[model samples]
Target: MSKVILITGTSTGFGKLMAITLANAGHNVIAGMRGVTAKNAEAAKELGALPNIEVAELDITSDNSVNEAISKTLTKYGKIDVLVNNAAVSGFGLLEAYSLDQIRNMFEVNFYGVLRTYNAVLPSMRANKNGLIINITSGASGHTLPFMIPYLASKFGVESITEGLQDELSQFGIENVSIQPGVYPTEMNNGSKSGIHADKPAIIDEYGDTATQQFNALGSALFSKMAEFKMDPQTIADGVLALVNMPKGERPLRYPLDAVAQGTDQEFIDARATIKAKWLAKYSN
Candidate 1:
């Protein structure tokens, strides 16, 4: 069955790989990104040329863009079978050094952006009583690391939301899962390299170069390892495909497609299942 799928953040990284792979697998895909006519025009053109793919303009932060994109998707495809919330931005270095606005903006995209898409698509999903939501989170969701506090916190927030949805939507047969990927050499690493929100002059004098210098050392080592063993984006694309093809109610809530052994997301998934079973029993009527 060729289902209609809408994916955000298709301009690069996991989103782009998943969009292309799913469409190639005979699914109807709507690839949504921020700059359809501008920065990502080439990507849009390429994906748009695919037989089952349509490129759409969607800035997940703006409710208007979110609504319009969903509306257009629904009008064309009747209903969306899956919504992949993959649009996310990351920042590194000291959490204290970055301004509040910088952290908030990252949160807007990583956390609230998913919320917008969830709000836009869940109505249709619940009405249909069958749909899927795959949030592309990170290994940072389950584990913490230095210098990446804000980015990891945002992922943690997304992780929490996805977990709640898993329990909340189970009765409706709408699956909500998070893909906690390990380090991959996607454009996201490029963003990480640029170190968005890495420095804050407000507190730099107080802390001096102590924290940032340590972060720089960590980055160098991590980048070297990434060059040696970075996971392919296809690892996640395949995971998404499997989750889509999985029978309803049989899919796990978290799929950690990680090459590195950072957080052991699979072990965490098992632990969560045990916890959910025991914990939710208390609330059962």
Candidate 2:
């Protein structure tokens, strides 16, 4: 069935690919992003030119923009069958390197952004009693590694939010699932917002050359893994398509796009399932 879908962060990477792919599959996709009239102008125009893709301004951090975007979509299409929270910003640095403000901003986009979108869509979905929410998380969601403390912390919050919604929204027939894609060659890896290190050189100096070298080495290894696996963004789009095609009430709560089968997310999920089953068996009965 053809459905109207709203996807955040459609300006680039998997969000952009998923927007095109879903639209190509006959779904009406509302691609939401910041800077549609500025930095992302070309992307917005290109996606808007597509047959079923509508580009709109949605800065997840802004409540007004989020409400307006949802209103526009609901008004035009009358319904949004799916809400894909794929928009995220990544910052890389040691936990102490980034300022609280920087960490807060990252959370605004990576964690609270999902919240804003969820709040906007929840009422309508409840009224209709049917909806799907696909949160684009990361393999680093439940845990963290070197140099991405802020990003991973935000992801952990998102993961918790998604999981909570997965259980809570079941009564409303709204399925909430998360896509935890492994490290892939995305623009976010370009270190655009590397973080508060350069500004806090004194702290780095305090940490000593050895700690700095170790952090650099860990980052190098992480990037090497990305180069080695080279996962494609299309795979994530296909994952989203799978959820769309899934029979209602039968979709899995989490999907891991671990291209190389590294088992970080899958292992965590397996352990989680065992624990959840035990808890349900003990507490529910």
lDDT of 2 at 136: 90
TM-score of each: 0.92, 0.94
lDDT of 2: 0.86
**Model 1, runs deviating above 4 Å:** 192-195, 275-285
Candidate 2 C-alpha lDDT tens digits along 190-221 = 65533323245566678888887998898787
Candidate 2 segments whose C-alpha is farther than 4 A from its true place: 192-199, 280-285
lDDT tens string, model 1, 112-184? 9999999999888888899999999987687789888889989989989999988798877898899988778
In candidate 1, where is summed lDDT lowest over 10 consecutive residues? 190-199
lDDT of 2 at 22: 96
| Candidate 2 vs. true structure, TM-score | 0.94
Superposed on all Cα atoms, the candidates' RMSDs to the truth, in angstroms, are 2.2, 1.9
lDDT of 2 at 133: 95
Q: Pick the TM-score winner.
A: 2
